[model samples]
Target: MRTPPQRGRRQGRTTSRELILGSARKLFAEHGYAATSLREIARDAGVDPAMVHHWFGGKEELFNACVELPADPAQVLGHVGELPAELRGEALLRALLTLWDSPAQPALLALLRNVTGSKAQAALIRQVLFKRMLALAMAGLPGSAAELERRGVLVASQMIGLMVARYLLRAEPLASAGHDELAALIAPVLQHYLTGPLPGTGSAVPGTGHG
Candidate 1:
């Protein structure tokens, strides 16, 4: 049989692990992926530095547990290029919209809502959504790799803007719009960001739409 001190130590270890997980979720929801650190999480959990490393491998693994990405955007998006050219925009938009509209949305929205209030949270959101999600979506386009990356970034910029308007700020029209309506209005713009010619390509353009 274990000694009394050993039983007490086991109970203490379980409690500490719970505390660490709780703190991690709150900090990740509040700050973001890139900004939160194991040390900071440890401090918040009121545990020793080594405890965090003992319980969770590192920040990345901790994030995977806390945020729980439902689908791997990198893996999901890799096949975007395989769709018929005309259908690509709709397909991509549908994928994103479906993911966001599902039950997973609450956690994602909570994270986004907290980002403006916490630097770490914003960093985390950016890395997950832009760096990982968009990077995977834009891979292997017919261009230089840098160009493809830039296109991915640009696409992210547009999507972020749309999300802010629709979900964050709750602007009129966009706020009231249903997912299908929003998708119709936004998918072509995303298409341009993904596969359209570069901005300086030989074309004269006139603009007439606002918002």
Candidate 2:
């Protein structure tokens, strides 16, 4: 009669990775992306900091794994690339549409739907927008960090609305709009939010006679 294998001793890397992931998820929900640290997650998991880095490279990668995000936010948004200021909005919009249409979209939509029912999940989504997506989109543009963040918030509102209306609610015409048509129609507005003048920035409104 052979003794049963010891499960704890046998499961080394797999168990440790799961522990890191579980710890990351709970800490991220409580403290958000910026506040959560890889070291803290590792400590919570009873793993060495080196183990967390070995498995997930960094905090961003760890967060991605916890959420089961199918694509890296950096890669998806980095599609904006380097382009003339005027051309970036359409490029960014196209990238977003492409992501939405990809096979990974189901995973993303699952996350989105979760936001409606869970405050923790909603905070997760918000943290991603502010810390990852918006920061990537707004980087290198002119303004103080606060102003840029404000612009990013406005951009987020429009993009979020488009995502919800077109994908979640299946609202008629928008849901049915061809990708190119939607991009062409909405890109300018996003562009304006991103790089154009805003009320508080001291740029005169085109028709309002106020700065």
Candidate 3:
């Protein structure tokens, strides 16, 4: 059998894992998820392909690591997409709110905090919002592709703002706000962003008139 190519200078376990992740984030961003390969990632990290599997089971898990999301987004948010379009906004929010209440909060907060100042991170964020979650939510819903994309981005913007305000920055009453209260306040705007028409001038969309 052909021996695997020699890897980079022997490195510590932590260094090896970090190298794999760094290589993964860049390649995933540049080439996208489907096009990137385990062999490619391993090669870039200067590790044996076996090391990639040892660190992260497979491509999905590897990508999850690159994103620092603790749960599979499909499992967490996928069901929300199955609901009626009108109900999706709230469902999505409630699902996320539920996850935030779990032990994953720290990792999620770190993800939100680190999204700034990194183009690769920004691209991964876009994939979650526009490519994955949005595709699932908007499936079978009516709208032009551009309009749907705009709505999806708006929805993502609100959710991100909520995460930062409530969890990361811990700003004011928002930080103290009850989950139900936040749901009541934010869900409608999310629904609107999903289906309501955008105004020609202001950012105001409906369900946002009060808070």
Q: Using TM-score as the measure, which candidate wins? A: 2
Better of 1 and 2 by lDDT: 2
Compared with the true structure, model 1 gives a TM-score of 0.64
Number of clashes recorded per candidate: 5, 0, 0
Question: Global lDDT of each model?
Answer: 0.71, 0.81, 0.82
lDDT of 2 by residue, 80-139 (tens): 745666676787788888999899888879978877867777777778777788777666
lDDT for position 174 in model 3:
84
What TM-score would candidate 2 get against the native? 0.84
RMSD vs true structure, all candidates: 6.0, 4.7, 4.4
The sequence of per-residue lDDT tens digits that candidate 1 reaches over residues 1-211 is 3232222587886787778887887787666656678899999989887777777778766776665565566556767756665556666777776776777777667766766756655655666776667655654557777776787787878777877777678898987887789878988888877777666643533464697
Pairs that collide in candidate 3 are none
Error of 3 at 157 (Å): 0.8
* lDDT-based ranking: 3, 2, 1
Instruction: Name the candidate, 2 or 3, with the larger TM-score value.
Output: 2
Poorly placed runs, candidate 3 (over 4 Å): 1-17, 46-51, 199-211
